[model samples]
Target chain A: MLKANNKVLVTISAIVLFFLIAPLIMVIITAFGTDATIAFPIHGFTLHWFANVFAQPDFVAGFKMSLIIALAASLLALVIGVPLVYALTRYNVHHQAWFQTLFLSPTFIPEIVIGFALYQGLVITVQLPLLLTLLIGHFLLCLPYVVRLVTASMVLMDEHIEEAAWVYGSSRLKAFLTVTIPNIRASLVAAFMLCFINSFNNIPISLFLNGPDLSMLPTAILNYLQNNYDPTVSAISVLLMLFTAAMMLLVEKGLGLKALNEM
Target chain B: MKNRSAFLLLLPGVLAICLFLFFPLLQTIWPTLGGSGYSHFLHSGYNRNVLGRTLLIAVITTALALGLGLPLALWIARQKASVKSLLSVVILFPILTNAVVRNFTWIIILGKDGVLNKVLLGLHLTQHPVTLLYTNAAIVIGSVYLFLPIMVTSLIGSVDELNIEVEEAAAVLGAKPWTTLTKVIIPQLTTGILTGSILVFAGAMTAYTTPQLLGGNRHLVMSTLIYQQAMTLGDWNQASVVAVVLIIMTVIVMGLMRLVTRWLDRRPANA
Candidate 1:
C-alpha cells in the first residue's frame, strides 16, 4: 500500500511538472525551429525568429514603453508605498481599517473593473495623457502589494529596535533611516520587483488603457496575435519568459523565494 | 511625530489610490446606476446565457483545480523540505511569467498538431491530431493552467499547517490511506479547499487574455463578452452592464463560498 502511494505521488509530481514546464519547452523549441509552422521534431534550427523579435517595430516600441512604465510605476510605488507602511505600522491612526482598505482595495477588486474604471475616469473624464495615466493606474494596481510586503517585513522585526534607537539618542526619522530601513532592505527590493512584474505583465489594465497611439508590450503582443499568428509571437514569448525568469533569479539571490510567496 | 511628517508620508500614496483606484471605480459604477443598462442586460436572454456559461466555466475550473490540487498538495506534504521548496517552484511558473506568455503556451500544447497530439499520434494512440484548440476544452485547460497555481498555493499553505500525527494515528488504528483521506484529511482541508476554489472561480470567470488567446470564439467568458460589447460593438453601456453583472456574480459566489466554509467549519463538532 505504501509503495502504491509512493508511485501515485511520483506520477502526480511528474504530470504536474510536465504541465508547468512543457509549454515553455514548446515555445523555446518553436522559437528556434526553422519552420514558420510550429510542429514537433524540428528538421532544421535557426536564429531568425530571435532576430525577427528585434526587427519588428511594434515589438521594439512596445518593449521600450513597457520597460518605461514598469520602471516608473515600481519606483513610484516604492516611494509612495514605503512611507505609508511606516505610518500605518508605527504611527497611531484613526480609522485604521479604513486606511488599510483604501490602500489594499485595488487588489481585492477585479482587474477588469479597475481597468474599466480608470478608462472612464482618467481618459474620458480627467483627460490625462496616456503615459501619465497608465503610470498612475499601474501605481495604484501595485501599491497594495508593496504595502503588504513592506509591512510584513516591519512586523517581522523586533519592535523595540526602533524604540531602542530613540533611547540611544536617535530621532524617529533618524532611527528609521538608519536602523529600520536597512533591516527591511530585502523586503524593499522584493516589493519593487513585485510591483515591477505586476506593472510589466499587466494586461487587463493595459487592455483598457492602451490607446491607438500607445501600447504596452503585452497589449501589443495581444493585438498582434489578434490579426496574425506566427512563430514571431513564440519568439517574443520565449524572450519574455526568459527575462522574467532572470528577474526572479535576481530577486531569489537578493531576498529568496519566500518573498514571492507573500504575493 | 504623528502630526506632520507621517501624515505627509502617507498622504501621497493614500491620495493616489483614492484618486486613481477608488474614484474611478465609482465613476464606472455611477453610469450603471440608472436601470436602463441593467434592464438591457437583465432582460436579454443572450446575456443571461452568457452569465450562466461564465458561472459554469468558473465552477468547472474550480472543480478541475480542486481535483488536481488536492493530490499534489498531499504529495508535497509528504516530501522532504528541500524537495518541497523546489517542487513549489514548478507551480509558480504560471505567475512568474506574463499571463499572455503563459496562455501562448496553450497554443503549442493544445493546438491542432500540437505537442500532445503529436505525441499521441506517434504513440499510435490515434490516427489524426485531435482538434483541441478553439474549443471550450481548450479554454478550460488554459484556465486550469492559469489558476492551478492559486489552488496549489492555498493548499500548500494549509497543508503545511496540517497535523501529520492525525494521519499516523489513523494508520495505527487500521484506517486505510484512502479511508483516512476522505474521513480525516479532506475534512480538515476546509480552509484550503475554500480559499482555492473561490480564487480559482473568480480568476477563471474574469480571465480575459487566456480565453481570448486559447478560447477564440468558441467560448465567451464574462470578461471577453465585456471586452467585445465595449470594444467591438462600441457599446459602453452594454459593456458596463456586463461588467457590473460580472462583479455582482463574483461577489455572490464569494459570499456563497464563505457560507460553505462556515458550514464546513461547523461540521466536525456535530460529527
Candidate 2:
C-alpha cells in the first residue's frame, strides 16, 4: 500500500513539475526561433535574439542601471539591517517588538501604494532625484528580509560564545566582529543575495519612480511587452531567470541552500 | 555610555524606516485631514466602492488559495523526502517567475481563441469559444495560481512539524481518521493557519499586476484607483487620501490578526 501511494505521489509531482517548467522552456525556445512571431515547434533556430539583446543599447543600459540599483539597495539594507539585528539580539531595547513590527509594515503595504506615496513624498516634499527615491523604495522592501534572516541566525546561535569572547576582555565591537559575524556569515550572505534579487526584480516602484533616463530591466521588459508582444520579451525573461539561478547557485556555494530554505 | 552605543547601533535603521515608510504614511494622513486646508477628499462615493471591491477580491482569493493548497499540502506532507523536495521546487517555480509574466501566460491561455477555448471546441464540449478574459473570474483564477504556492508551503511547514504519535494514539483509542484530524492535528496548526491567512490576505489586498492585466480597465481596486488618481489623472491630493485610507485599513487588519494570535496563544491547552 505504501509503495502504491508513493508511486501515485511521484506521478502527481511529475505532472506539477512539467506544468511549472513548460512556460520557461517554451520561452527559451521561442527566444531562439528565427520567426518574428512566437510559435511552438519552431521552424528554425539561431542565436539572433541573443545578439539582438546584446546589440540593443536600451537593453544594455537598462541592465546596467538595474544592476547598480540592486547592488546599492542591497548593500544599504545590509548596512542598516545588521546593526538592528545585533541590537535586537544583544540588548533589551525599549519597545523592541514595536520596532520589529514597524520595520516589517512596509512589506504588508501594497507595492503600488508604496510607489505612489514615495512619488508624492519625493516630488512634492523632499524634491529628491528619481534614482534616490527608487533606492529608498527598494531598500525599504528588502529591509525586512535582511532583518528576519539575521535575527533568525542570532536566535539559533549559542549566547555563551559571545559571552566567552567578552570574558576574554574583548571590546564589544571586537567581540561582535570575531564572534557573532563569523557565526552568522552564512545568513548574512543569503540575506544579501535575496535582497539583490528582489531589488532587481522590483517593478511597481521602478514604474512610478523611473524618469526618462532611468529605466530598470523589469520596467523595460514591461514596456516592450505592452507595446510589442514579441519574442524579445521572452529573451529578456530567459536571461533574467538564468542570471537569478546563477546568482542563487553562487550563494549556495558560499553558504548553503539549506540556510535559504530555512528562511 | 553603554546605552548610547546601543542606541547608536539602532539609529540608522530606525531613521531609514521612519523617513521612508512611516513618514510617508504620516504625510499621507495629513493631506487627507485637510492639512493644506483642502477637504476635497471628504466624499466617500468612489472610495467606498474601491475598498469594497478590494476586500471582496481578497477574501475570495484567500478562500480559493486555502481550498486548493490545504489538500495538496496534506498529501505532500505524507510523502517521502525526495518526493517532497521535488514537489516543493515544482510548486515554487511560479512564485519565482515574474508576476507580470505569469499573468500574461494566463492571458494567452484565456484569450478568446486561446488554448482552453481551442481544446473545448475541438472536443465538442462547447460550440463556441468562451469569453474568459477581462472578467472577475479570470482575476480570481490568476490570483489563486499565484498565491497557492505560499499557502501550500506554510501548511506543509506546520504539518511537517506536528508530532504524528498523538494522532496515532488517538486512532488507537478508537478515534476515526476524520476525528483524529479534527481533534488531534488541527488545533496544533492554529498558529500556522493564522500566519498563513494573514500573509495571504495582505498579498491579495495589495495585488496589482494580476488584477490590472486580467480584470481590464472596467475593474478598479484601491491600488489601481490610487495609481489612476496619481499617475493618470495627476491628482496627488486624491491619491494621497486613497493611499492613506488603504494603509489605515491594512494596519487595522494586521492589528486584528495580532490580537487573535495573542488570544489563541493565551487559551488553555486542553480547551
- Name the best candidate (by lDDT): 1
Residue B141 in candidate 1, Cα distance off native in Å: 0.6
For residues B199-230, what per-residue lDDT tens digits would candidate 1 score against the true structure? 89888888888889987875787888888888
For the second chain, the TM-scores of the candidates in order are 0.87, 0.89
Task: Note the clash tally of each candidate.
Answer: 0, 0
lDDT of 2 at A90: 84
User: Once superposed on the true structure, which residue ranges of model 1 sit more than 4 Å away at CA?
Assistant: A1-5, B1-6, B116-131, B253-271
Off by over 4 Å in 2: A1-35, A40-47, B35-47, B169-184
List native contact recovery per candidate, as a fraction of 1: 0.64, 0.30
lDDT of each: 0.82, 0.76
TM-score of 1: 0.93
* Model 1 lDDT, residue B129, Cα: 85
lDDT of 1 by residue, A74-107 (tens): 9988888888888888888778768886787776
